[model samples]
Target: MAKRIDVADLNIYYGETLAVQDVSMSIEPRSVTALIGPSGCGKSTFLRSLNRMHELIPKARVEGKVMVDGQDLYAPDVDPVAVRSQIGMVFQRPNPFPTMSIYDNVAAGIKLNAKRMRTSELDEIVERSLRQANLWDEVKDRLDKPGTGLSGGQQQRLCIARAIAVRPDVLLMDEPCSALDPISTQKIEDLITELKADYTIVIVTHNMQQAARVSDTTAFFNLRGIGQPGQLVEIGDTATIFSAPANKATEDYISGRFG
Candidate 1:
Protein backbone atom coordinates (compact mmCIF):
# COMPACT_ATOMS: atom_id res chain seq x y z
CA MET A 1 0.00 0.00 0.00
CA ALA A 2 1.11 3.57 -0.65
CA LYS A 3 1.95 5.73 2.36
CA ARG A 4 1.95 9.43 3.24
CA ILE A 5 4.93 11.12 4.91
CA ASP A 6 4.81 14.11 7.26
CA VAL A 7 8.08 15.69 8.26
CA ALA A 8 8.06 18.18 11.13
CA ASP A 9 10.81 20.62 12.01
CA LEU A 10 13.40 18.32 10.54
CA ASN A 11 17.06 19.17 10.94
CA ILE A 12 19.80 17.13 9.34
CA TYR A 13 23.42 17.35 10.46
CA TYR A 14 26.81 15.90 9.75
CA GLY A 15 28.55 15.90 13.12
CA GLU A 16 28.73 19.54 14.21
CA THR A 17 27.50 21.09 10.98
CA LEU A 18 23.85 21.34 10.05
CA ALA A 19 23.17 20.60 6.40
CA VAL A 20 19.40 20.91 6.02
CA GLN A 21 17.43 22.93 8.50
CA ASP A 22 13.85 22.94 9.79
CA VAL A 23 12.07 21.31 6.89
CA SER A 24 8.41 20.45 7.33
CA MET A 25 6.21 19.09 4.62
CA SER A 26 3.52 16.53 3.88
CA ILE A 27 4.06 14.16 1.00
CA GLU A 28 0.78 12.70 -0.16
CA PRO A 29 0.30 9.06 -1.00
CA ARG A 30 -0.09 8.06 -4.64
CA SER A 31 1.41 11.34 -5.82
CA VAL A 32 4.77 12.73 -6.87
CA THR A 33 6.50 15.53 -4.98
CA ALA A 34 9.61 17.17 -6.42
CA LEU A 35 12.27 18.94 -4.42
CA ILE A 36 14.03 21.62 -6.49
CA GLY A 37 16.97 23.72 -5.43
CA PRO A 38 20.38 25.08 -6.30
CA SER A 39 23.50 23.00 -5.99
CA GLY A 40 24.60 22.41 -2.35
CA CYS A 41 21.17 23.42 -1.11
CA GLY A 42 20.59 20.13 0.76
CA LYS A 43 17.94 18.89 -1.64
CA SER A 44 19.54 15.46 -1.81
CA THR A 45 20.32 15.46 1.87
CA PHE A 46 16.68 16.19 2.67
CA LEU A 47 15.59 13.43 0.29
CA ARG A 48 17.89 10.92 2.00
CA SER A 49 16.45 11.84 5.38
CA LEU A 50 13.04 10.61 4.26
CA ASN A 51 14.21 6.97 4.48
CA ARG A 52 16.95 7.34 7.09
CA MET A 53 19.64 7.06 4.42
CA HIS A 54 21.30 10.29 5.50
CA GLU A 55 22.28 8.85 8.87
CA LEU A 56 24.44 6.25 7.20
CA ILE A 57 27.15 8.87 6.73
CA PRO A 58 29.73 9.08 9.51
CA LYS A 59 28.54 11.21 12.44
CA ALA A 60 25.31 12.05 10.62
CA ARG A 61 22.06 12.40 12.54
CA VAL A 62 18.63 14.02 12.45
CA GLU A 63 16.73 16.01 15.06
CA GLY A 64 13.03 16.04 14.35
CA LYS A 65 10.14 13.80 13.45
CA VAL A 66 9.59 11.97 10.20
CA MET A 67 6.23 10.29 10.45
CA VAL A 68 4.67 7.84 8.04
CA ASP A 69 1.04 6.93 8.53
CA GLY A 70 1.27 8.15 12.12
CA GLN A 71 4.36 6.14 13.11
CA ASP A 72 7.47 8.09 13.98
CA LEU A 73 10.38 6.73 11.92
CA TYR A 74 12.92 7.85 14.49
CA ALA A 75 11.28 6.33 17.52
CA PRO A 76 13.44 4.35 19.92
CA ASP A 77 12.21 0.93 18.83
CA VAL A 78 11.92 1.51 15.09
CA ASP A 79 14.63 -0.22 13.09
CA PRO A 80 16.45 1.71 10.37
CA VAL A 81 16.71 -1.41 8.21
CA ALA A 82 12.97 -1.97 8.38
CA VAL A 83 12.36 1.71 7.67
CA ARG A 84 14.52 1.38 4.54
CA SER A 85 12.64 -1.69 3.41
CA GLN A 86 9.31 0.14 3.63
CA ILE A 87 10.71 3.26 1.94
CA GLY A 88 13.06 2.30 -0.89
CA MET A 89 15.41 4.68 -2.71
CA VAL A 90 16.86 5.02 -6.24
CA PHE A 91 20.00 7.11 -6.41
CA GLN A 92 21.15 9.87 -8.79
CA ARG A 93 23.24 7.50 -10.88
CA PRO A 94 22.23 4.13 -12.25
CA ASN A 95 23.84 1.78 -9.78
CA PRO A 96 22.68 -1.71 -10.59
CA PHE A 97 24.81 -4.27 -8.75
CA PRO A 98 27.63 -5.01 -11.21
CA THR A 99 28.15 -8.58 -10.00
CA MET A 100 24.44 -9.46 -9.92
CA SER A 101 22.41 -10.62 -12.89
CA ILE A 102 19.26 -8.73 -13.90
CA TYR A 103 17.04 -11.24 -12.15
CA ASP A 104 19.25 -11.38 -9.07
CA ASN A 105 19.36 -7.60 -8.78
CA VAL A 106 15.59 -7.44 -8.45
CA ALA A 107 15.48 -10.55 -6.26
CA ALA A 108 18.19 -9.38 -3.87
CA GLY A 109 15.92 -7.24 -1.70
CA ILE A 110 13.15 -9.80 -1.65
CA LYS A 111 15.53 -12.59 -0.68
CA LEU A 112 17.09 -10.54 2.10
CA ASN A 113 13.68 -9.82 3.59
CA ALA A 114 12.26 -13.27 3.12
CA LYS A 115 14.39 -16.19 4.26
CA ARG A 116 12.23 -18.80 2.55
CA MET A 117 10.36 -18.48 -0.74
CA ARG A 118 9.62 -20.78 -3.64
CA THR A 119 11.61 -20.24 -6.81
CA SER A 120 8.37 -19.72 -8.69
CA GLU A 121 7.33 -16.98 -6.30
CA LEU A 122 10.71 -15.30 -6.61
CA ASP A 123 10.51 -15.53 -10.38
CA GLU A 124 7.06 -13.98 -10.37
CA ILE A 125 8.27 -11.08 -8.23
CA VAL A 126 11.27 -10.39 -10.45
CA GLU A 127 9.11 -10.41 -13.56
CA ARG A 128 6.47 -8.18 -12.00
CA SER A 129 9.05 -5.70 -10.72
CA LEU A 130 10.83 -5.53 -14.05
CA ARG A 131 7.53 -5.01 -15.79
CA GLN A 132 6.63 -2.30 -13.30
CA ALA A 133 9.87 -0.58 -14.17
CA ASN A 134 9.05 -1.02 -17.88
CA LEU A 135 12.18 -3.11 -18.43
CA TRP A 136 10.75 -6.62 -18.64
CA ASP A 137 10.11 -6.86 -22.41
CA GLU A 138 13.62 -5.69 -23.20
CA VAL A 139 15.55 -8.01 -20.87
CA LYS A 140 13.36 -11.07 -20.44
CA ASP A 141 15.58 -12.92 -22.91
CA ARG A 142 18.73 -12.45 -20.84
CA LEU A 143 17.73 -12.65 -17.20
CA ASP A 144 21.06 -14.15 -16.30
CA LYS A 145 23.14 -11.40 -17.87
CA PRO A 146 24.98 -8.94 -15.62
CA GLY A 147 22.80 -5.91 -14.82
CA THR A 148 25.56 -3.55 -15.93
CA GLY A 149 25.39 -4.99 -19.42
CA LEU A 150 22.23 -3.01 -20.18
CA SER A 151 22.21 0.48 -21.66
CA GLY A 152 22.31 3.41 -19.24
CA GLY A 153 18.53 3.85 -19.26
CA GLN A 154 17.88 0.13 -18.95
CA GLN A 155 20.30 -0.08 -16.05
CA GLN A 156 18.46 2.74 -14.26
CA ARG A 157 15.16 0.99 -14.83
CA LEU A 158 16.71 -2.20 -13.49
CA CYS A 159 17.72 -0.27 -10.37
CA ILE A 160 14.13 0.88 -10.11
CA ALA A 161 13.04 -2.74 -10.43
CA ARG A 162 15.40 -3.71 -7.63
CA ALA A 163 14.05 -0.94 -5.41
CA ILE A 164 10.43 -1.89 -6.04
CA ALA A 165 10.82 -5.69 -5.82
CA VAL A 166 10.45 -5.59 -2.06
CA ARG A 167 7.16 -3.69 -2.39
CA PRO A 168 8.07 -0.44 -0.69
CA ASP A 169 5.22 1.96 0.03
CA VAL A 170 7.30 5.03 -0.84
CA LEU A 171 10.13 5.65 -3.35
CA LEU A 172 12.83 8.26 -3.14
CA MET A 173 14.66 9.27 -6.31
CA ASP A 174 17.64 11.64 -6.35
CA GLU A 175 18.29 13.03 -9.83
CA PRO A 176 17.37 9.64 -11.30
CA CYS A 177 17.55 11.02 -14.83
CA SER A 178 20.47 13.45 -14.56
CA ALA A 179 22.99 10.97 -15.93
CA LEU A 180 20.87 9.83 -18.86
CA ASP A 181 20.66 11.10 -22.41
CA PRO A 182 17.63 13.17 -23.40
CA ILE A 183 15.68 10.22 -24.79
CA SER A 184 16.54 8.14 -21.76
CA THR A 185 15.54 11.05 -19.54
CA GLN A 186 12.18 11.19 -21.26
CA LYS A 187 11.66 7.48 -20.65
CA ILE A 188 12.51 7.92 -16.98
CA GLU A 189 10.17 10.90 -16.71
CA ASP A 190 7.43 8.75 -18.20
CA LEU A 191 8.23 5.93 -15.78
CA ILE A 192 8.13 8.30 -12.81
CA THR A 193 4.73 9.57 -13.94
CA GLU A 194 3.47 5.99 -14.05
CA LEU A 195 5.04 4.90 -10.74
CA LYS A 196 3.24 7.52 -8.65
CA ALA A 197 -0.05 5.72 -9.17
CA ASP A 198 1.33 2.96 -6.92
CA TYR A 199 4.02 4.61 -4.82
CA THR A 200 4.42 7.86 -2.91
CA ILE A 201 7.37 9.41 -4.72
CA VAL A 202 9.71 12.21 -3.67
CA ILE A 203 12.35 13.28 -6.15
CA VAL A 204 15.17 15.79 -5.91
CA THR A 205 16.05 17.35 -9.23
CA HIS A 206 18.07 20.33 -10.42
CA ASN A 207 16.00 20.45 -13.58
CA MET A 208 13.11 22.80 -12.93
CA GLN A 209 11.21 21.76 -16.03
CA GLN A 210 11.39 18.10 -15.10
CA ALA A 211 9.93 18.89 -11.69
CA ALA A 212 7.15 20.92 -13.23
CA ARG A 213 6.35 18.10 -15.63
CA VAL A 214 6.43 15.18 -13.18
CA SER A 215 5.36 16.41 -9.79
CA ASP A 216 2.00 17.33 -8.30
CA THR A 217 3.78 19.47 -5.72
CA THR A 218 7.08 21.35 -5.88
CA ALA A 219 9.39 22.49 -3.09
CA PHE A 220 12.25 24.94 -3.40
CA PHE A 221 15.25 24.76 -1.10
CA ASN A 222 18.01 27.30 -0.81
CA LEU A 223 20.91 28.42 1.33
CA ARG A 224 21.85 31.83 2.70
CA GLY A 225 25.53 31.51 1.90
CA ILE A 226 28.34 29.01 1.34
CA GLY A 227 28.51 27.66 4.89
CA GLN A 228 24.83 28.18 5.74
CA PRO A 229 22.43 25.29 6.24
CA GLY A 230 19.90 24.76 3.48
CA GLN A 231 16.22 25.53 4.10
CA LEU A 232 12.91 25.16 2.34
CA VAL A 233 11.89 28.46 0.81
CA GLU A 234 8.44 27.54 -0.43
CA ILE A 235 6.25 24.66 -1.56
CA GLY A 236 2.99 24.49 -3.49
CA ASP A 237 1.16 22.99 -6.44
CA THR A 238 3.47 22.68 -9.42
CA ALA A 239 1.33 24.91 -11.60
CA THR A 240 1.23 27.66 -9.04
CA ILE A 241 4.92 27.35 -8.33
CA PHE A 242 5.65 27.72 -12.03
CA SER A 243 3.08 30.33 -12.92
CA ALA A 244 3.07 32.59 -9.89
CA PRO A 245 5.17 31.40 -7.03
CA ALA A 246 4.54 33.17 -3.73
CA ASN A 247 8.25 33.43 -3.00
CA LYS A 248 10.51 35.74 -4.98
CA ALA A 249 13.40 33.29 -4.73
CA THR A 250 11.30 30.52 -6.28
CA GLU A 251 10.19 32.79 -9.08
CA ASP A 252 13.74 33.95 -9.73
CA TYR A 253 15.07 30.41 -9.79
CA ILE A 254 12.29 29.21 -12.07
CA SER A 255 12.92 32.10 -14.44
CA GLY A 256 16.66 31.32 -14.55
CA ARG A 257 17.52 34.62 -12.87
CA PHE A 258 19.70 32.94 -10.24
CA GLY A 259 20.46 29.56 -8.79
Candidate 2:
Protein backbone atom coordinates (compact mmCIF):
# COMPACT_ATOMS: atom_id res chain seq x y z
CA MET A 1 0.00 0.00 0.00
CA ALA A 2 1.16 3.54 -0.76
CA LYS A 3 1.46 5.98 2.17
CA ARG A 4 1.70 9.76 2.30
CA ILE A 5 3.78 11.77 4.77
CA ASP A 6 2.57 15.11 6.07
CA VAL A 7 4.80 17.33 8.14
CA ALA A 8 2.87 19.99 10.06
CA ASP A 9 4.76 23.04 11.33
CA LEU A 10 7.78 20.92 12.19
CA ASN A 11 10.70 22.15 14.23
CA ILE A 12 13.82 20.27 15.26
CA TYR A 13 16.23 20.87 18.10
CA TYR A 14 19.51 19.47 19.19
CA GLY A 15 19.68 20.12 22.90
CA GLU A 16 19.37 23.92 23.12
CA THR A 17 19.99 24.63 19.46
CA LEU A 18 17.12 24.82 17.01
CA ALA A 19 18.27 23.13 13.83
CA VAL A 20 15.23 23.48 11.60
CA GLN A 21 12.29 25.86 11.89
CA ASP A 22 8.63 25.75 10.93
CA VAL A 23 9.01 23.31 8.03
CA SER A 24 5.85 21.82 6.63
CA MET A 25 5.20 19.75 3.50
CA SER A 26 3.28 16.77 2.19
CA ILE A 27 5.01 13.77 0.60
CA GLU A 28 2.89 12.26 -2.14
CA PRO A 29 2.18 8.54 -1.89
CA ARG A 30 4.36 6.18 -3.92
CA SER A 31 6.31 9.08 -5.32
CA VAL A 32 9.89 10.29 -4.98
CA THR A 33 10.55 13.48 -3.01
CA ALA A 34 14.08 14.84 -2.98
CA LEU A 35 15.38 17.14 -0.27
CA ILE A 36 18.29 19.22 -1.58
CA GLY A 37 20.54 21.79 0.03
CA PRO A 38 24.08 22.77 0.83
CA SER A 39 25.90 21.27 3.79
CA GLY A 40 24.48 22.36 7.19
CA CYS A 41 21.27 23.47 5.49
CA GLY A 42 19.26 20.85 7.44
CA LYS A 43 18.24 18.62 4.54
CA SER A 44 19.63 15.55 6.26
CA THR A 45 18.37 16.68 9.65
CA PHE A 46 14.88 17.18 8.30
CA LEU A 47 14.91 13.80 6.60
CA ARG A 48 15.93 12.12 9.84
CA SER A 49 13.07 13.78 11.67
CA LEU A 50 10.56 12.33 9.24
CA ASN A 51 11.04 8.82 10.63
CA ARG A 52 11.77 9.93 14.20
CA MET A 53 15.33 8.61 13.74
CA HIS A 54 16.59 11.95 14.97
CA GLU A 55 15.19 11.10 18.39
CA LEU A 56 17.64 8.23 18.64
CA ILE A 57 20.52 10.69 18.95
CA PRO A 58 21.29 12.03 22.41
CA LYS A 59 19.86 15.53 22.94
CA ALA A 60 18.06 15.45 19.59
CA ARG A 61 14.38 16.30 19.71
CA VAL A 62 11.54 17.45 17.49
CA GLU A 63 8.12 19.15 17.79
CA GLY A 64 4.93 19.04 15.72
CA LYS A 65 3.21 16.19 14.04
CA VAL A 66 4.68 13.98 11.29
CA MET A 67 1.80 11.99 9.94
CA VAL A 68 2.44 8.75 8.06
CA ASP A 69 -0.68 7.64 6.30
CA GLY A 70 -3.12 9.24 8.80
CA GLN A 71 -1.40 8.43 12.12
CA ASP A 72 0.89 10.68 14.11
CA LEU A 73 4.26 8.98 14.43
CA TYR A 74 5.19 10.75 17.65
CA ALA A 75 1.85 10.47 19.40
CA PRO A 76 1.84 9.01 22.87
CA ASP A 77 1.47 5.23 22.94
CA VAL A 78 2.64 5.02 19.33
CA ASP A 79 5.68 2.78 19.11
CA PRO A 80 8.65 4.41 17.40
CA VAL A 81 9.96 0.96 16.66
CA ALA A 82 6.75 0.10 14.87
CA VAL A 83 6.84 3.42 13.05
CA ARG A 84 10.45 2.77 11.94
CA SER A 85 9.58 -0.71 10.79
CA GLN A 86 6.98 0.78 8.50
CA ILE A 87 9.54 3.31 7.21
CA GLY A 88 13.00 1.93 6.50
CA MET A 89 16.25 3.86 5.91
CA VAL A 90 19.38 3.50 3.81
CA PHE A 91 22.43 5.45 4.85
CA GLN A 92 25.05 7.58 3.06
CA ARG A 93 27.38 4.63 3.16
CA PRO A 94 26.67 0.99 2.50
CA ASN A 95 26.33 -0.63 5.91
CA PRO A 96 25.66 -4.31 5.57
CA PHE A 97 26.74 -6.39 8.55
CA PRO A 98 30.37 -7.42 8.05
CA THR A 99 30.10 -10.89 9.46
CA MET A 100 26.78 -11.81 7.89
CA SER A 101 26.30 -13.40 4.46
CA ILE A 102 24.31 -11.71 1.68
CA TYR A 103 21.36 -14.02 2.26
CA ASP A 104 21.51 -13.42 6.00
CA ASN A 105 21.53 -9.64 5.56
CA VAL A 106 18.28 -9.65 3.60
CA ALA A 107 16.67 -12.22 5.88
CA ALA A 108 17.52 -10.22 8.99
CA GLY A 109 14.61 -7.79 8.57
CA ILE A 110 12.08 -10.54 8.04
CA LYS A 111 13.32 -12.40 11.07
CA LEU A 112 13.10 -9.31 13.25
CA ASN A 113 9.64 -8.23 12.10
CA ALA A 114 8.15 -11.67 11.69
CA LYS A 115 8.26 -14.91 13.61
CA ARG A 116 9.88 -18.10 12.40
CA MET A 117 8.99 -19.26 8.95
CA ARG A 118 9.47 -22.47 6.95
CA THR A 119 12.84 -22.76 5.23
CA SER A 120 11.16 -22.70 1.81
CA GLU A 121 9.23 -19.54 2.59
CA LEU A 122 12.39 -17.83 3.87
CA ASP A 123 14.28 -18.76 0.70
CA GLU A 124 11.54 -17.38 -1.49
CA ILE A 125 11.44 -14.10 0.37
CA VAL A 126 15.20 -13.72 0.16
CA GLU A 127 15.18 -14.43 -3.54
CA ARG A 128 12.31 -12.07 -4.26
CA SER A 129 13.73 -9.24 -2.16
CA LEU A 130 17.19 -9.49 -3.71
CA ARG A 131 15.74 -9.65 -7.19
CA GLN A 132 13.60 -6.63 -6.46
CA ALA A 133 16.74 -4.79 -5.39
CA ASN A 134 18.51 -5.91 -8.60
CA LEU A 135 21.15 -7.68 -6.57
CA TRP A 136 19.95 -11.25 -7.00
CA ASP A 137 21.78 -11.98 -10.27
CA GLU A 138 25.00 -10.57 -8.86
CA VAL A 139 24.89 -12.22 -5.46
CA LYS A 140 22.83 -15.35 -6.08
CA ASP A 141 25.82 -17.52 -6.79
CA ARG A 142 27.52 -16.28 -3.65
CA LEU A 143 24.59 -16.35 -1.25
CA ASP A 144 26.76 -17.74 1.50
CA LYS A 145 29.55 -15.23 0.97
CA PRO A 146 30.00 -12.49 3.52
CA GLY A 147 28.16 -9.27 2.61
CA THR A 148 31.39 -7.32 3.01
CA GLY A 149 32.95 -9.38 0.26
CA LEU A 150 30.84 -7.66 -2.36
CA SER A 151 31.76 -4.43 -4.15
CA GLY A 152 30.52 -1.12 -2.76
CA GLY A 153 27.66 -1.17 -5.23
CA GLN A 154 26.75 -4.73 -4.38
CA GLN A 155 26.94 -4.02 -0.66
CA GLN A 156 24.68 -1.02 -1.16
CA ARG A 157 22.25 -3.20 -3.07
CA LEU A 158 22.34 -5.71 -0.21
CA CYS A 159 21.45 -2.93 2.21
CA ILE A 160 18.57 -1.90 -0.05
CA ALA A 161 17.44 -5.50 -0.26
CA ARG A 162 17.47 -5.60 3.50
CA ALA A 163 15.35 -2.43 3.74
CA ILE A 164 12.63 -3.64 1.37
CA ALA A 165 12.55 -7.21 2.64
CA VAL A 166 10.27 -5.97 5.40
CA ARG A 167 7.91 -4.27 2.93
CA PRO A 168 8.19 -0.75 4.33
CA ASP A 169 5.69 1.91 3.31
CA VAL A 170 8.37 4.62 3.15
CA LEU A 171 12.07 4.37 2.31
CA LEU A 172 14.40 7.15 3.44
CA MET A 173 17.73 7.22 1.60
CA ASP A 174 20.48 9.52 2.82
CA GLU A 175 22.83 9.90 -0.15
CA PRO A 176 22.88 6.23 -0.98
CA CYS A 177 25.08 6.80 -4.02
CA SER A 178 27.67 9.17 -2.59
CA ALA A 179 30.41 6.60 -2.15
CA LEU A 180 29.97 4.73 -5.40
CA ASP A 181 31.35 5.05 -8.92
CA PRO A 182 29.13 6.42 -11.68
CA ILE A 183 28.03 3.03 -12.95
CA SER A 184 27.19 1.84 -9.47
CA THR A 185 25.43 5.12 -8.73
CA GLN A 186 23.34 4.72 -11.86
CA LYS A 187 22.16 1.30 -10.73
CA ILE A 188 20.99 2.56 -7.37
CA GLU A 189 19.42 5.57 -9.04
CA ASP A 190 17.49 3.36 -11.44
CA LEU A 191 16.39 1.16 -8.60
CA ILE A 192 15.04 4.19 -6.76
CA THR A 193 12.98 5.19 -9.80
CA GLU A 194 11.56 1.68 -10.07
CA LEU A 195 10.85 1.20 -6.37
CA LYS A 196 8.53 4.22 -6.24
CA ALA A 197 5.81 1.99 -7.55
CA ASP A 198 5.33 0.49 -4.09
CA TYR A 199 7.15 2.81 -1.66
CA THR A 200 7.12 6.48 -0.87
CA ILE A 201 10.79 7.52 -1.15
CA VAL A 202 12.41 10.56 0.43
CA ILE A 203 16.03 11.30 -0.45
CA VAL A 204 18.47 13.79 1.10
CA THR A 205 20.89 14.79 -1.61
CA HIS A 206 23.67 17.31 -2.07
CA ASN A 207 23.61 16.48 -5.78
CA MET A 208 21.00 18.57 -7.56
CA GLN A 209 21.21 16.57 -10.79
CA GLN A 210 20.49 13.41 -8.80
CA ALA A 211 17.43 15.04 -7.28
CA ALA A 212 16.25 16.10 -10.73
CA ARG A 213 16.86 12.66 -12.22
CA VAL A 214 14.86 10.68 -9.65
CA SER A 215 12.35 12.92 -7.95
CA ASP A 216 8.75 13.69 -8.76
CA THR A 217 9.03 16.70 -6.47
CA THR A 218 11.95 18.67 -5.06
CA ALA A 219 12.33 20.82 -1.92
CA PHE A 220 15.17 23.28 -1.62
CA PHE A 221 16.39 24.11 1.87
CA ASN A 222 18.55 27.02 2.90
CA LEU A 223 19.81 28.49 6.15
CA ARG A 224 18.07 31.70 7.14
CA GLY A 225 21.21 33.62 8.13
CA ILE A 226 24.60 33.25 9.67
CA GLY A 227 24.23 31.06 12.78
CA GLN A 228 20.49 30.82 12.25
CA PRO A 229 18.34 27.72 11.59
CA GLY A 230 17.65 26.30 8.15
CA GLN A 231 14.25 26.56 6.47
CA LEU A 232 12.49 25.24 3.39
CA VAL A 233 13.07 27.80 0.66
CA GLU A 234 10.83 26.17 -1.92
CA ILE A 235 8.83 23.06 -2.75
CA GLY A 236 7.25 22.18 -6.08
CA ASP A 237 7.13 19.70 -8.92
CA THR A 238 10.58 18.72 -10.17
CA ALA A 239 10.15 20.52 -13.48
CA THR A 240 8.84 23.70 -11.91
CA ILE A 241 11.55 23.92 -9.29
CA PHE A 242 14.32 23.28 -11.81
CA SER A 243 13.04 25.50 -14.55
CA ALA A 244 10.96 28.27 -12.98
CA PRO A 245 11.14 28.23 -9.20
CA ALA A 246 8.72 30.52 -7.39
CA ASN A 247 11.36 31.41 -4.79
CA LYS A 248 14.42 33.37 -5.86
CA ALA A 249 16.51 31.44 -3.36
CA THR A 250 15.59 28.15 -5.00
CA GLU A 251 16.24 29.54 -8.43
CA ASP A 252 19.63 30.86 -7.39
CA TYR A 253 20.71 27.65 -5.73
CA ILE A 254 19.74 25.40 -8.63
CA SER A 255 21.40 27.71 -11.13
CA GLY A 256 24.67 27.80 -9.11
CA ARG A 257 24.21 31.46 -8.30
CA PHE A 258 24.02 31.01 -4.53
CA GLY A 259 23.53 28.50 -1.77
Say which candidate scores most in lDDT: 1
TM-score list, all predictions: 0.99, 0.98
Task: Estimate candidate 1's alpha-carbon lDDT, on a 0 to 1 scale.
Answer: 0.95
Model 1: how far residue 58 lies from native, Å: 0.9
Cα lDDT, model 2, residue 173: 97
Per-residue accuracy of model 1 over 1-259 as CA lDDT, tens digit each: 9999999999999999999999999999999999998999999999999999998999999999999999999999999999999999999899998899999999999889866889998999999999999999999999999999999999999999999999999999999999999999999999999999999999999998899899999999999788999999999999999999999988899999988
Which pairs of residues clash in candidate 1, taking residues 3 or more apart in a chain or in different chains?
Answer: none
Question: Which residues of candidate 1, in runs, are more than 4 Å off?
Answer: none
* Window of ten residues with lowest summed lDDT in model 1: 109-118
**lDDT for residue 235 in candidate 1, whole number 0-100:** 91
Off by over 4 Å in 2: none
Each model's lDDT comes to 0.95, 0.92
Q: State the displacement of the C-alpha of residue 183, model 1, in Å, after optimal TM-score superposition.
A: 1.0
